[model samples]
Each structure stands twice: as structure tokens, then as C-alpha cells.
Target chain A: MPNRQITIAELPTDTLEPRHFQLTETDMPKPGEGEVLLRVILMSIDAANRSWMRGATYRDAVKAGDGMPTYAICEVMESNSPRIAKGDIVAAEATWADYTVTKAHKVQKMPKVEPLSHLMSVYGIAGKTAFHGLMSIGNPLPGETVLVSAAAGSVGGYVGQIAKALGCRVVGIAGGAEKCKWVEDELGFDACVDYREGNLSKKLAAACPNGVDIYFDNVGGKILESALNFMNERGRVVCCGAISQYDTDTPTGPRNLPGVVVVKRLRMEGFIVMDFAHDDAKCVRAMQHWVSTGQIKVFEDIVDGLENAPKALIGLLAGDNKGKRLVRVGADPK
Target chain B: MPNRQITIAELPTDTLEPRHFQLTETDMPKPGEGEVLLRVILMSIDAANRSWMRGATYRDAVKAGDGMPTYAICEVMESNSPRIAKGDIVAAEATWADYTVTKAHKVQKMPKVEPLSHLMSVYGIAGKTAFHGLMSIGNPLPGETVLVSAAAGSVGGYVGQIAKALGCRVVGIAGGAEKCKWVEDELGFDACVDYREGNLSKKLAAACPNGVDIYFDNVGGKILESALNFMNERGRVVCCGAISQYDTDTPTGPRNLPGVVVVKRLRMEGFIVMDFAHDDAKCVRAMQHWVSTGQIKVFEDIVDGLENAPKALIGLLAGDNKGKRLVRVGADPK
Candidate 1:
């Protein structure tokens, strides 16, 4: 069988476009010793993918002609190691491809669910990221206000819902009026501000009358700047992602940082979801409870076909998707 | 006795000069009920005093025609409140005046020490600030690389020495070759980089080859910008003061902030010494031990007379003082 893969055509110096990636087909290969062949099922599309191309961050830098890295759910088609059996569903560091080959130890075996896409949404990166960044970094107290940017996006939608589940006042900042309404009405946030509308500081101040105690920042730049102005004394700013500045070469930062950080005695910290991988079982248990109770709503925006992966990411960067965005590459195991 | 006072003739829109203040003779303040009449023995000049004129910070904002506020060592003349007694030495919120009248309850009584200025330098605000910020915020571990800015100045001098006493590798960034040399030879830092010489990022990288684990920031702006580039993953940035931005109208912030902060997983926290006031005795105990063991060296730059108070502050902000800068307003009790 032929394996279709999306590869980076050229490194983006400024804004990334669909043309930056090209789809190519190659012959499928057999698994080597201690390795397993994976049929890529669902591939997670995140802002961090765009950031990887910018340069090396927490992960290795993506270069021209490199397969786009992704966090994906795959089925063990052929296993050479005794640790994994054929037909076992696992999660691993994958690429925007129809199939992937990795060491058996590198893949994490996942439990079966009614809907396999749930593994790519609530039980996967988006839900876990929101849980960890909000709980571990933000450390939200009951009744405290949590102000999150990119409210309608994958991790952010979960962040607000999780903050609400923890009995905190959750407010969101999304790009437009439609996203803001969905964030407030569907996600059940206490308030949602449209960043596209001017006077964010005033609007945020009005929405958060008590001031923000925890700011879960996904989109940095002007939103982060405005959030800094509304933070209460000794507040925590969870620096999850800087999607606003990720697509550009000329990225402007907050002009009042470290100064406002000093005056307010604020604690601004950052972390990757992988940092809390050891606590995954614990995170999953809590998330499962919230999901079952309906306190946490799961919304997976799935795009079909491997060919649309580039377009999905580009649209995601432009604030197109509403929830956990994933690209379905192949058929689910029946 | 006539009280000679320095009042802010006008608030500076940009750089503060001696001409912004005027020395005037006023009637000595009398003790009212629950108040004490204090003879200001010595006044501590700090960069934060200039920050106050810019706008409100941890303290109230200073306006035009207001007396320049100071942290001072004083001799109690008359006490209306039984909590404090006459002839007791105390530290309180005073001003650039020979006499001050404040609530007796607000004063902290001090133990008599020879050269009383030691109470203003090592055991006072400068020492406590360095202690609290380094120990509490920076959380320095032994054998860690600690990078401090404004190394020859009041708080920075003590910060480097304290970090040294804690068995950490301490590098300082100061202005001019003389100050840098003084910081290395006199203050005992591992290395001192003169920021004025240009190419701070290169020099800092060369100095801290192990990479900076904790950055004790004092003079924000470009120094902070350069320091962020050299911070190791999971580093801590102690935001003590921003003297560089305090004197200027147009203050530029670190352009890579919250981005570098995210990628590095750094914990950049800010604080006021008063936030740790409950642990003052503990801080003083540790500081006194360091001072007695010769691990911490104390330097007091005493500028004589109340008239020079404005000049002393201006010069201190301009990086003229080598250590804790003070203005002597009245004679110490015999």
C-alpha cells in the first residue's frame, strides 16, 4: 500500500501558508526489530505545531522537507516487540502521515473508549493541557477568577470549562463575537470578551469586577498585555502558548512585563503537558469524573482525510476551529 | 529647632535632577495623641523613591510639592503612645526632613549598634530586600549560577554577597569598568560585566557557561532583555526593582518576555520586602550571621547633610553610589 505524508516544503520566515507543506506518496515499509508499524488514526493539530517550525522550543525544530510532527492515536498494525500486541491502540509522537514506525517503548497503550475520537479530545493533549496548566500552574482557588485567552480554541475551551468545574469564575477572550458567544453560552463561561472589539482592558475589567486571580494564557501578545493589567495582586499567569505571535516574524511582546509583574508580585510560569506525563492517570481519573458528571463538555472538531491536514492547521491558526481540532487520517478499528 | 526639609518642587516627567527639589526651613513637627516626634538621624535613598514619582506602586504616588518620602533611622524625642518610649532608636517612614511626626505604633524599635548606619545598610531595607528576594523568590540552591544586575549598587551588592555566602556562583552586571571591578574585587562576585561596554548577551553567555539558573533583576529594561536570553530551562527570575525604567518617561520592556519565559519554563516572580515583613527577624538573623562570619561585607555610601538628599538620590539613580546610599540629616543620640 502507498503511504501519503505531508512534508514541509520550505521554512516560513513570516506567516505560514498551506503552500508551505506538500503531500507526497511513498511505499509502506516493514517494522524493524523492537519497532511497531502504526496506522495513523487521528492526528492532533495544535498551535505548538506552528511554533515548532519557528525554531527549537520544548521539541526539536522542524526544518524544510521534514514530516510535520504530531501527537497522534494509531493502531498497532504489526509489532516486532513482545510488549505490544497487534490491534492495540496507542498514542505516540507521529507525523502528518498515513503510517508511522517507532520503537515499542515510545508508544503509550490507551484504553478503549466508545468513540475513539474522545482519545484525541478529552482524554488526550487538549484536555490534559488545560487540566495541567490550569490546575498545576494557575492553581485556581474556589471563587477565584480565571481569565483565559483563545477561549473558543481547543485547550482554551477546556480551560474555562475546567475552571468552572473547580468552582471558579471563568472568563474567556476569543477572536470574534460568534466565538465569544459560544464560549460563554455553550462552554458556560461566566463572561467572554471579543478581542476583535476594541478596548479589551476596559471590557475585561468590567467582566472581571473582582480582577483576575489566574490568567490561563494561550494566545500571547496584546491579549497577554491586557490580561496583565487586570491581574490581582499575587496572581498567577499560566503561559501555555503564544499563538498570536507564533505565525509572524515580527512578534511584538508585552510592553509592561516584569514591571507589572513586579508591582503586582505576580508569578508568571510556563510548562508543557509532557512535564506532567507521570500524573496522567491521576489527570485522566479526574477528567473522567468531570466528563461523566457533564461538568466538562467535550467538543471535538474533526477534519476528514490526510490531505486536509495543512489547511486544518492554517485555519486553526486563524482561529477557525471551536474545540479540540483533530485530522482523521484513516478508518477506525471496528 | 527649625526643620530643614526637601520638598518636590515639581515631579519629573523624565529624568529626575536636584533642581526638581527645593530645601526649605519649616517648624519642627510636634507629637499629637498616639504620635511620636522623631529626630531623623539618617535617611535611606532608594531607586523605588523615584518609581513612586512615576506613579503609585507598592506605596502611594508622589505628586508635585510633596515631601520626598524615605526609609529612615530615627531617635524618638517624644512619644504619646506607650508602645514606644522616648530616646528609643527606631526605623519608620520619614522624609527628607530633620524632624518627623508619625504614629508611634508604625515605628519599629531597633537595638543600639555602633556606627548606627549599619542598621541602615546591612541590617535594614537594603539587606532585608536582598535577603527576602534572593532566599524567598530566587530560591537559590548551592552550586547554582545566580546572575544579578546593578551589582555595585545597594541591593545588588548584598544580593551577590548573600548568594556567595549560600555557596552559589554569582555574576553581576553593573555600569562602567570601575563599578564592575569593584563588584568583582570588593563584593566578591564570580564575574562582573559592565553593561555600558555593549554586547551584554555575549558577555553574560561567556560568564555563565553553565547558564543562569536564577536571575536577580534590579535595573529592568535592556539588562533584563539580555538576561532572559541566557536563562536556563526552569530558571527563576527575581524581580526586585526596575531602576532603569524608573527615571525615564518612555520605558521599554524586555521584548522576548513571556515567550522566553514560556520556552525556558522560567518562574519570574516580583515582590516587595514588606510582603516578607513577618519574617524580618529571621532575615535579620541570617544577615547578621553572614555579616559576623565575614561572608557578607557591608558598604555604606554616606552623603552628608539634608541639602544633598536630592543630589544623593539623583546620583544613586545615575549609578554613582557603590553601595547602600544614605543622607545624614541629624546627629545620632550620644
Candidate 2:
């Protein structure tokens, strides 16, 4: 059988054009002694992909020309390790490819949960980023106001649900009415402010009358400014992502920041998820418990083909995806 | 004896003209119950006086025309309260006036650990401001590197000493050779960087090779930017005053801040000593202990007479004062 693989051919420019991705069919290699051949089932699409394309974010941190970064749902196609036998469902850091092989340590055993796609999503890096941002940086207490920007998306959805479950008054800020409704009614956010609506600052203030205590900032332009204005004294702002500013050639600084932090005594910290990679098991266990108890909801916006990965990623950045944007590559052998 | 009172007859614009202050000789009234007549000795001349003259800083948070705010060393001329008696030396809030009547509660019993002038100098607001900025906001831990701007001044002098006593590697930024040598030798700073000599960024980086863990910022602008650049991960910057920008009509913000805080997770907080009035006793007691043990040295630049108050304050803003700048309105009776 012919194996398939993906390669980083050309880097994307300022704008991530469709031509940036060069798809070529190549023969996949056999598994080493401790390796497992994974038949890629689903691949996640994230704003972080834009950084991978531009060759900026991970250039110095991680090696260059490392096969395009991705997280994928897979099945053990073949394995030398007894831990993951053929046909065992798993999740691994693969690529925008159909089949790939990695060491057993790299392959995580996806737990049997309510929704299988969640293993590649709400229980994935995106989810963990939000979880850590909330738990460690946020330190949200019961009855406190928890404000989340990009709140209808993957990490935002989980963040809202978790804060709600933790007894916080969760408020979300998204681009449209549909996203706002989903955040309020589906994820059970106490209120959702549509940032696209005129007078976002006033609307956000009205939505969070008591003022924001914990701000999970994903969009970091005007939304950040609005949240800063609404923050209560000694508020915590977790800078998990700056999706709004990520695409620009040059990022804009927070103008009102000095006054904001000074007047309110606020704490705003930016962090990478891998900083808390040591606490993976803790995050997974807590998320699993929440899933089993039905206290949290996981949503995946699945696109059915590996060929559509680039478009899916583009759509994800455009706020077109409703939840954890997933590109279905192949069938899960399980 | 005729009682004389001083009033802000006119507001100052660009400079302190004679009309800005009005002296009126009034009849000396009998001391009311629980009040004492304070024969003003030493008065604090601070840039905060400039703000007090403006009647506001950022907003109308601190209104102007509050009878010219000053912290003074005074002799109790007469007292009706049992706690305070005539001819006792004390520290109280007196204006730019020669004699002012204040309640016994408004006065603190002078500690004999230091000279009456030194106590009214370092142990007063200027010194307490430094202590609070270092311990509370800057939070310099043992063996950490602390960078203090305006090192030879009242606040910065105490900041270097406190940080040194706490086992920190202290670096000072001052204008001239005299100030720099005084900071390094007398204040016990590990090194002193002459900010007036050359490129502040390069100098600061060289001075703090290990990176700055805490920055006690009195001189804002370029010093702030330099301090921000050399900040280690999780560094804390305490903005007690922005003397570097105090003279300007509109203060300039540090442009390099976003890059600094985002990369190092640095926290910059502004504080006023009055905000900690609830725990003022704790601060005073600790300072008193430090003073008595010779662990901390107090510096005073005393200008004799009430008439020289304006010139002394102007000299303070011009960076003339060697230590805590005070105006001796009258001699200490004790």
C-alpha cells in the first residue's frame, strides 16, 4: 500500500494565501522499534497555524522545517510497541497528512469519552491552554465576573463552561449574534456581548454590570481595551492569544494599559501552553471528570477531507468555524 | 504674638511667581481642645507639590488648592491635649506656613532614634514612599538585582539601602558623578549607572548583567524603558513617582513597555503611600527599628526658614536636594 506524507515546501507571506501549502504524495516509512504507524483521522485548525505558515512563532523555539505543526486524531496502523497495538484509537502530533508514524511516547491513548472528536479538541492543546490560563493566571473565584473574548470558539467555549460550573458569572464577547447565542444558550454563559455591534465598550459594560474580575483574552485589539476598562480592581487578564493582532505585519501595543493596570492594580500576563506541559495529566483528568459529569460541553466543527485542511485553517482564522475546527483526514480503524 | 497664615492666593502656571503665595498676619486664636499649635520646623518639598498645585494628576483624584500639601517637622508651641505638651518635637502635616494649629491625632510623637531633622526627613513620607515601593510593589527578594532611578534623592536613597539590606544586588541611576558615587558608597548600591553620561539602555544592561528583578522607578521615561529592557522574568516595577516627567506639561509613556512585559512577564504597579494608611503603623514601626539599628541611614537637605520653602521645592524638582528635601520653618524646641 502506498503511504502518504506532507512537507513544508514554501513559507507563507504576510497574508496566508492558499498557494502557501504544496501538497505532494510520498511513500511513508516503516515504524521503528518503539514507533507506531498512525492512520490520521482528524487534524485541528488553529490561529497558531498562521504563525507556522509565516515561519515566525516557532522559528527559534522549535526547529525550522519540522513538518508543519499539527495535532491529529489517528488509529494505530502498525506498531512495534505492545502498548498501542494495530487498530487502537489514538491522538498524536502529526501533520496535515493522511498517514504518519511516531514513537509510542508521542502517541497519546485517546480516552473513550462521550464524543470521540473531543480527544483531538476540548481535551487537546487548545483546551489545555484555556484551562491553564484560567486556573493559574485567572484564579477566578465564585460569584466573580469571568469575561472571555472569542468565546464561541473551541477554547473559549470550554473556558466559559468551566467558569460557569465553577460558579462564576461568565460573560462572552464574540463577533456576531449567532456566536453570541451559542455562547449564552449552548455553553451556558451568563451573558454574551456581540462585539461587532456598535458601542462594544458600552455593550460589554452593560453585559458585565458588576465589572470583569477574570479576563481570558484571545482577541487582543479593541476587545482587550474594552475588557481593561471593565476590569474590577485587582483583576487578572490572561493573555492566552492575540488572534486579532496576530495577522498584522506589526502588532499594536495596548495604549490604555499603563492607566488600566495602574488605576485598577490589574495583573496581565502572557503565557505559552507548553509552559505548563508538566501539568498535562492534571488538566486531562479534570476535563475528563467534567465531561463524564456532563457539567461541560465540547463542540467540533468538522470539515470532511484532508484536501480541505488549508481552507479549514483559513476559515478558522476568519471566525467561520463554530467550535474546535477539525479536518477529517481518514477513517478511525476503531 | 501675631499669628501668620499663608494661602495659595493665586495658581501657578509656568513658574512660582510671588503672587502665588499670600501671607496674612492674623490674631492667634486660643488652642481648641485636643489641638496643638505647631511651630513649623522642617517642611517636605516634593514634585508631588507640582501635582498638588495643578489640583490633579491623572483625573481629579487629588483635587488642587488643598492648602498646599506639605509634611513638616514642627515644635509643639502649645497643646490642650494630654498626649502632647508644649515644647515637644513632632512631625505633622503643616503647609508652607510658619505656624499652623493641628489636632493631636494629626501629629505623631517624634522618635528620638534619629535627629529631629533626619526623622522628619527619611522616616517621613519620602522615606516611607521608598520603603513601600520597594517592599510592597517592587518585592525584591534576597539575592535579586534591584535597579533604582534617581538614586541620590530622598526616595531612591532609601530604596537602595532597603534593597541592599534585604540581600539584593542594588544598582542606581543618577545624573552626575557626585550623585553616582554617593549612591554607590553611602547608600551601599552594588553599582551606580550615570544615566546622564550616555545611552541609558546600554548602561543599564551593563550595570545589571544578571537582569533586574525589581525596579524602583522615580525617574520615569528613558530610565523606565531602560529598566524594562533589563528586567528578568517575573520582574516587578514599582512606580512611586514619575519625577523624570513631572516637569513636562504632558508626560510621555514608555514605548518599549509591551515588548518588555510580554517577554519577561513583568508587572508594573503605581502606588501612593496614603493608600496604605490603614497599615501606616506597621510601616512606621519597621522604619523606626531600621533607623535605630543603624541598618538604614537617613539623609536630610534642610533649608532654614518658611520664606525659602518655594525655592527649596523648586530646587527639589531641579534635583538639587541630596537626600530628603525639607524646609526648616522654625527651630526644634526639644
> lDDT per residue, candidate 1, A211-267, as tens digits?
999999988888898899899999999998889888888777776777888899999
Q: Give per-residue CA lDDT, model 2, range B1-334, as digits (tens).
A: 8765666776666555556676667777567999998887777888777655654343342232335667777788889999998878887877677778889988987765435776755667877788777888877789899888888888888888888878899999888888899888887889998877888888777888899888887877666766777877778878667675555555555555444454466666777776676776787788778878887887878887777776777777778778888777776554
Candidate 1: which pairs clash? none
Q: What does the lDDT read for residue A63 in candidate 1?
A: 99
What value of lDDT does candidate 1 attain over all alpha carbons?
A: 0.91
Chain B TM-score for each model? 0.98, 0.88
What CA RMSD would you report for each candidate? 1.3, 4.5
Taken over the whole model, the C-alpha lDDT of each candidate is 0.91, 0.76
Task: Estimate the TM-score for candidate 2.
Answer: 0.81
Name the docking class for model 1: medium
User: What is the Cα-based lDDT of residue A324 in candidate 1?
Assistant: 92
